[model samples]
Target: MASAGMRRRVEAIPGRPLPYGILGGCTEVIDVEDEHELLGVEWMALGCCPVEVWNDPCVGADESPGAPAKKQFCRPTIEHADPITVYAGAECGTMGWSYAEARQHAEASLDLGQQEAVELGFWTNHLAATATDLTPAEGPVDIAQGVAALEGCLAEQYGGVGVLHVPAGAAALLGCCNVVQRDPGGGPPTTLAGNCAVIGAGYSTANTGPGGIPADPGTAWLYITGPVVVRRGPAMTVPDRPGPSINYRTNTQRVLVERTYVVATTCTVCAVAVTTCPS
Candidate 1:
């Protein structure tokens, strides 16, 4: 028999460590996918407005001042937001978990939201492999040849600065080009012939056409005179608040957390799609 004080001390002694038989885990989470970036021509945020309209300006030979200015009528170009919502959530038993785990979940949810925006930007602008039609290229693309093809189209259309969005496979070929390679000795960086910027996109893919028909993967290379514009509409308004918000729910004594936002993508006429290339 133990004394009263001794019994209290024994009782206070901690039992098995928390989570019983579970082992400790590393704090770091490995990310296998390439992070998405805003690679297109441009980005703009329009709050509350559902549509934007602009008048197309003419660019060509100017008419003689005295010759009665030609009745120049410009067409209005309109861009509308196609709102999309993306969200992520997690639930854990109302008990044991460190704040570290909660932080990880929050970070992952944010990443998913941004990734959705990137994919929308990439697919919004539809382009054809050739000037003739919407058909994509049939096979692997020769980087040099492919670039040249794109240059021709750019010159024919809107010819200022251009950007190329290439998938992993196309990027590999582009990487082998002299333009992308750095000089062994200190020298000026080689420039792509047309003063174009090449961006490698991890999210590039062979998008499906109407009725689920697979389009060409090579069409992944998008040529644009400007940046892809990602617009944020009225933040998904929650009932209680006037802006985007995260809500919580309780189920089976567990808490579920979720967040959401509304976003859209727009492309200008300056963007051209190049589908014929190696996957």
Candidate 2:
């Protein structure tokens, strides 16, 4: 039979659903077991360079090529460790909670932290660099107008496979549009437009404002792009002590969980298009 403490630990695991699926779909995850790794860089040539005319036959064909040169680069990856600690008093342990339960909480907390970090990185680094401002004129955005503008932006910069990411507010607006369908199992509406799939969750315009402060509540940001490449390096877990150590004097037991990983994007073309709609 399981002890009361063991039962408590099992019960402590929360039933709350996580947002892991959303993260998995939106970004490419590269898992590593080491502290750091190197990621290769490849990009398309911006344009063709003008060809030079050589008067001398001895100038050689190599010296007068009419095409632009293309090159690739590499970058070293750096790892960041995020750690969280949780403690349960000795009295609480006696009441049925165990050190294992505390560890479970710590792990869950770290997982959520990692997800947040990835989301923030995508927004600040990738999306911010290649965004198109589409602030509306004194009213909520019209779905048709918004879709047209998004298509135009993609056509102008990148007209390849893409996905649309919007915050809850913007998603709600999109859901009400006649062009959007609630069921993915069903065929898309006949009037549906654009080449990107819509994901109404896993995004926020908050903390994207100047100085990292939260943006206006009415502000909404949308993203359209090819796959987002995320590279992850080795994740290590370190405990504060080798085994469960109890401090009788303080009547408390504690554990610390440390995790290290690396993540970055490696998209060559205009991988992401940002659209900002104002309230």
Candidate 3:
């Protein structure tokens, strides 16, 4: 027999609804340290500046059997200032390649992609004479000699906000900034785990960033951006138990904001304003 009481209760229940910011996105700067440009061209500090990078979407587990499998690694979804990525590190591959070669390869990649090099951090390096005020020589050069020459050119060119990437072997050449060397020798061409930043001999630090140095303290983690936000609100809270609770104080919140990102672009590109791309 049908129960009228049960039917009344069911009818009294409210309709279900969805929420926002669940899959939200932020258009921030370049995620990683790739294709980044120094504000005025002299990247001599451990300072952190806005960089332009790329972000690749993950493939669904069952959607594309032919596509590359997604990593078991954790991903974020929140709207970030640099959604593409950030790090003292990204992923370091095993082989070591020359800085010049790498730069050329990166440039080739742009050409292959038909990319217009607006004003990315991508640049050509020269070991000029050493001086705060530098004038880059266009003659034949050696990394050591080129570095000395670079310093002179840097005085007027370097804003001290970007990372001065040198030949993997020439990092020690520049002498204006405070630096505790990481990779003493030009080891293998390695990359960071999260941000894909190439460090060690390839990068010589003269400055630091708002988040301190870019070096990672963990063996597995090169550098972490921000894992500082923890939700405590009752509405967004969940119990501490029950393995996979989404409504309670559970543990899978990486889904709530993990995969999302923010892409912050340069405020101005060569005085024209990169913000012109969009708001």
Which candidate achieves the best lDDT against the true structure?
A: 2
lDDT of 3 by residue, 72-137 (tens): 432322222222211111111223433333334333333232111111112101111111222123
RMSD in Å for all candidates:
14.8, 9.3, 28.5
Q: Which candidate is the best by TM-score?
A: 2
How do the predictions measure up, each by TM-score? 0.46, 0.55, 0.20
- Give the per-residue lDDT of model 2 (tens digit) for 1-279: 987767642344444323322344445555544433423233442311223443654355576677654454435334222321222222234224467665665556555555544455455555555555553555335555665565555555544444454554455456454544443645322225434343422345333532333445555555555434455544333344425545566656555554433333222222222234532
Alpha carbon lDDT of each predicted model: 0.36, 0.44, 0.22
Better of 1 and 2 by TM-score: 2
Which runs of model 3 end up more than 4 angstroms from their true locations? 1-140, 158-163, 167-279
119, model 3: CA deviation in Å?
17
